[model samples]
Target: MKNLILTTAALALGAGMAMADTVRMGTEGAYPPYNFINDAGEIDGFEREVGDELCKRAQLECEWVKNDWDSIIPNLVSGNYDTIIAGMSITAERDEVIDFTQDYYPPTASAYVATSADADVTGGVVAAQTATIQAGHVAESGATLVEFATPEETIAAVRNGEADAVLADRDYLVPLVEESNGELVFVGDPVPLGGGVGMGLRESDAELRGKFDAAITSMKEDGTLNEMLKKWFGEDTATYAPDGSVVTN
Candidate 1:
């Protein structure tokens, strides 16, 4: 009876460990159409759908974690989460500290928006979210770069004239522009930046990364990824072709 009791206790402990292996998917809940808090206060957006599907396909129990954009990567490194499903672009600079699944979203352009179409985006003060590729590009583009902690603040800077323009992902800016009632407009030619968006994982989680990469590939091959992209980003958004190449509109 003593040996049986010990065995049962050990089995219970093992079951609890297995249950605790839920993968935490980190994201910035502020970025809409990517990841945001819905009316129900739950993570809801394209990444949420994609992440949930990936988790299902990979057979991994997953949960969503919201983190600030500025500290997202650092928190991931500190083991605050198991993966970053934020709309993080894959970059060589970031790859130094973390691993990434294969590209889930294709390379997209960054555009400058302002109150007028003729805003001096190339040579004027430009706002960008800090620590993003858009911010880095603005810093080197000969434009005076104003860094904001959040994407919303960058747009507010442009609206209030703190910056002449705000540079951000075209996909993120399109809806804002349309809803602006002519208050905002694209000011300059869209600049291509970053390779593509991918899931960021710790450097040590190669296996976990592989699972997601495979799930993404499966989605791509089955045309589900393209469907999701179009559903969230509009019909003209870039998508994966049958040959696995990106079909940009």
Candidate 2:
């Protein structure tokens, strides 16, 4: 439960003033394909590309800020950043705390990876990133849920025999499973949850949210969002239509 530590000057200036007119985009720079730190130590991934385009369409000055996944929401609310463009799914619980733009990415699948194809994913110790839908599902699914601060740690738990399986976004796990050769394999049907992935904003920032919402709408209508999805998540990934319908190609 590590928290964001800000300087006295930073806190005194107020979180909103940290960027003045520029919108600070907050993300967990650990989730690959969605977001991760590149070799040059800069944020890189699907969210980075999408966030840049959204800012371009909204005509807003924007910059990226890396934050830990465990504190991402709290940091956004505290004004460490103006918006969250992380791979965060829209959920009712989160919606009550922070408003979200129209979904940029449709609700996708969650899958479990275990050492053996026949592993009892539904009943064994399951590792999942803290504060995620997959973790919540595991907590309520009669399995022992072991929470980790980062996505990589969740997978590591499975690999090190600390957990029987790891549940995470299918798109995130696909590459790992494939690269693991026979060490890891899918064990159960994909579990779908949340509404979709959207930018998180404070309730008071309706104007900012509206701008991103419109940008997302435009991307879906023109298929740029879909193209980016395929480029990062693969051509077979499910995408969102202009009206938010799930369109698999």
Candidate 3:
């Protein structure tokens, strides 16, 4: 299923490769609230709102292209997309390959969710999205890591007993746990990972990166970034104030 999605995205991107003047924003339109395909089959969510504003402020003509998460970075390097505005975290390893704009979202916690409260998240099989920090963490934590191509598959793995638990961003898991009622529950302490979420760009596109960085800085100064974060992640989350201070609950 994941392969099919990637193949379709590749074919669609091949149909009309990016022109010289237009910027193509690449995202994994599968993660909700951060990014997702709405009922209308269009990309919609917090990153969508933030990306649109950044483009407007940077005065760039931009278009959004959905890609599977696993190949998001490679496709960007291949020129299938101009910028990756996905909920990608800024990390040293990733920095070795692509330049990143200043973070639009602050560092958040990764959490464990399981069908049983007694599930040993630390010692048993844990599921995470492939190529994500959570997966990397699980791999090094002495736990058996089972990687899935999508967030939904990780949850499914837990439900089907294929994995003991699923580790993912806390904000993304909260709603799912609530909706699951007594079926699923958060099972361990939240683990902090990554620096923050930033936009990925080609190293040669320093000008483009600077434009987005400036736009993000402007939004931070005006408090618009915090407002959008609150709207999507909720008011209780840690937010950046216009005075450059972080306020947390």
Candidate 4:
């Protein structure tokens, strides 16, 4: 009986260790209300929230790492981290590089921006993620837009008037300007670019992609996802918030 008991304990320990699923994620700790570094030196924001949720749903452990925007894709491809969930959008160009899980949130659904001038550089190169909707807008426009290493850089450019305007997910910037002293305003409605944040998995690790997508879909089904959204964007802040819509307390 003693030998049998020892074997059972060993097996249990092994199973426990095996079941301890861990996923490493990367994000830019700059985009406030999304993902940013706090005074406590801890990472927090909307994107982080989504990452946490997916981990819980998938019953996996999650470890977050601070990453520079310019190097995020390269690092993910290099296997530095298990995945990236830093408000990363789904794009054709990126799709060519890596596999992705189903979207956890709408891409530009709640993301919009404003500037000193309503010049409408929606298709111009002003301010946007390199391969995101904002960049697409800049590309469509004839203006020269700038790409920065992170969202904080873009927001700073807008705040200082160094750039014409900063374009990102509207939900992110709306709260920013409202919290600011008074130097920013919306240019138009929330531009629907038809995308959202998703986990970027390695092209070879298709198995993990299925795991993440299943987790994301489960969150969508349960009310946990909705509750999380409300906590971030208020009861009505995130849902149905169109472009140019004023969302302030």
Q: What TM-score quantifies how close candidate 2 is to the native fold?
A: 0.90
User: Candidate 4 on 139-215: residue-level lDDT in tens?
Assistant: 56676788665567777776666667776767777678888766777776656664556777767777678778887
Candidate 4 versus the native: TM-score? 0.77
lDDT of 3 by residue, 1-249 (tens): 111112122212222232458899999999888999999999999999999999999999899999989888778877888898778888877776777998888878888999988999889999998878788789889899999889999999999999999999888898999999789998978888877788988777887888899999999899999999999988897877776566787
Candidate 3 residue pairs in backbone clash: none
Residue-level lDDT tens digits of model 2 in 73-156: 778777888898888887766776777898877777888999988777878899998877788788899999999988899999
- Which of candidates 2 and 4 reaches a greater TM-score? 2
**TM-scores for every candidate against the unseen true structure:** 0.90, 0.90, 0.91, 0.77
Best model per lDDT: 3
Superposed model 1: Cα runs more than 4 Å off = 1-20
* Model 2 spans with C-alpha error above 4 angstroms: 1-19, 242-244
Off by over 4 Å in 3: 1-19, 243-245
Clashing pairs in 2: none
Minimal lDDT window, size 10, model 2: 1-10
Question: Lowest summed-lDDT stretch of 10 residues in model 4?
Answer: 1-10
Better of 1 and 4 by TM-score: 1
- Angstrom error of the Cα, residue 27, model 4: value is 1.7
lDDT of each: 0.82, 0.82, 0.84, 0.63
lDDT of 3: 0.84
